[model samples]
Target: MKPAAFEYHAPATAGEAVELLAEWGDEAKAIAGGQSLMPMMLLRLTVFDHLVDLRRLHELRGIRQREQAVWIGAGTTHSAVGRSDLIRQSAPLLARATPLIGHAQIRNRGTLGGSIAHADAAAEYPAVALTLDAEFELLSPRGTRTVAAADFFTGMWATALEPDELLTGITVPEWHGRRGFAIEEFARRSGDFAMAGATVAVGLDADSRIDRCAIGLFGLGPGPERAHHIEREVLGSHVREVSAEEVGRAATARLTSVPADLHGSANYRKRLGAVLVARAWQRAVEEATDD
Candidate 1:
């Protein structure tokens, strides 16, 4: 199927894109990479009178450390993110999670901001962003503002972005050293959307004990969700003594309150979520404790 006829506007700057959005409002859609928007457009699930292409916005196209956080241009490709040494050193959780998004081809074209804006409940980036407490930058005619990842994703395929705003960048705190991070998902194939998944990040104190931890769950809720109860349970525990079964049981109790779905029963998804969480926690602990 072909997308509906629309006027195309390629903007070389975010300000130019914002101007287009301000003029067209709900009738226009800002497209970066087209990985998410184009498919929906072709199926007519959504329509636009104008398409604002953002590939030429060079201002929004790099990854660098600013203050205590790493700012990634919204236009940065998943492939570039997955392969970035800077990301690997500063925010390894994000680097680890990027390859889990889809196949190589999908990663090649998928933009970080595009995925975040799309807000796929089972997508890797949203969960990672949430786990990392990432911040999103939104530009509009009004001005630019930042939104925390926790508040950015409001629902499945929904975000806090106003119709006239464009996502310009993402900021993640630098994870320095002595940190463990992992991403795990259950799916039928390599590129399939996950049936269940979890992204985990842990910071160990000098004593080699869990000091801080963040767990973001996907495919088990309306949107990416932080497993706060589980994080609380694991804090202060020694990495060597961490128990997957205990963590899994706790996660099951917390996540199974919802109804079932066609992909799996609510209980099944909860179980999957628990197992993934446990696996991620264990792996992250190992990575963090590595000499």
Candidate 2:
């Protein structure tokens, strides 16, 4: 199907994009890469009176290491994230997960900000961001504001971004200690949205005890869900001492609230969540231990 006719405006800078959004109000939709929005628009699932193109916003593109964080511009593509040596060194978990997003072609055209802004429950980035505790920078005509990943995603296909706000960049803290990270996702095919997935980041103390850990899972709730209970349980326990089955059980129990969908039953999804978390946790432990 063809999309409805709309006025198109290409902005050279983020401020210009903000001004365009402010002028068009809710009628305007900012597009970068157009991986998600274009399909929805073509199907008439979503319509916009004005299309604000952000391809020229060079300010919103790059990867850099600041004092204690890695800053990734919103315009950076998934392929870039997957291939970046800086990201591989500073944010290994993200690097590991980026390649798993669709395939090479999708990765080439899909933007990091687009995926996060889309906030699809089945997306890999949202769960990864939540695990990394990444920060999102949102720009608007009024001003700029930063939101933690936990607060940025409000619900399925929903976020805290105002209609006039454009996500400018993402900030991920550097992991300094002995760390291991892993992403485990189950999809019918290589490029399909995951049925259930887990992104785990684990850091070990000198004694090999789990000092810090994050478990972010998706495909089980309105949006990506954090496995807080599992984290609490794993902390202080040695990876060798922790029972993945027990952790899996605990994970399954906490997901009672996730609704059933056509792809999976609520119970089935809960089981998959448990399995993913256990596998991701085990692998992360191994990686961190080897480091």
Among these predictions, the greatest lDDT belongs to: 2
lDDT of each: 0.88, 0.90
lDDT value, candidate 1, whole model: 0.88
Query: For candidate 2, lDDT tens digit of each residue in 174-203?
Result: 887889999999998999988889888999
lDDT, candidate 1, 114-160, per-residue tens? 99999988888999999999999999999999999989999878999
Residue pairs in clash, model 1: none
Model 2: CA > 4 A from native: 257-259
Which segments of candidate 1 are over 4 A away from where they belong? Answer: 256-261
TM-score of each: 0.95, 0.97
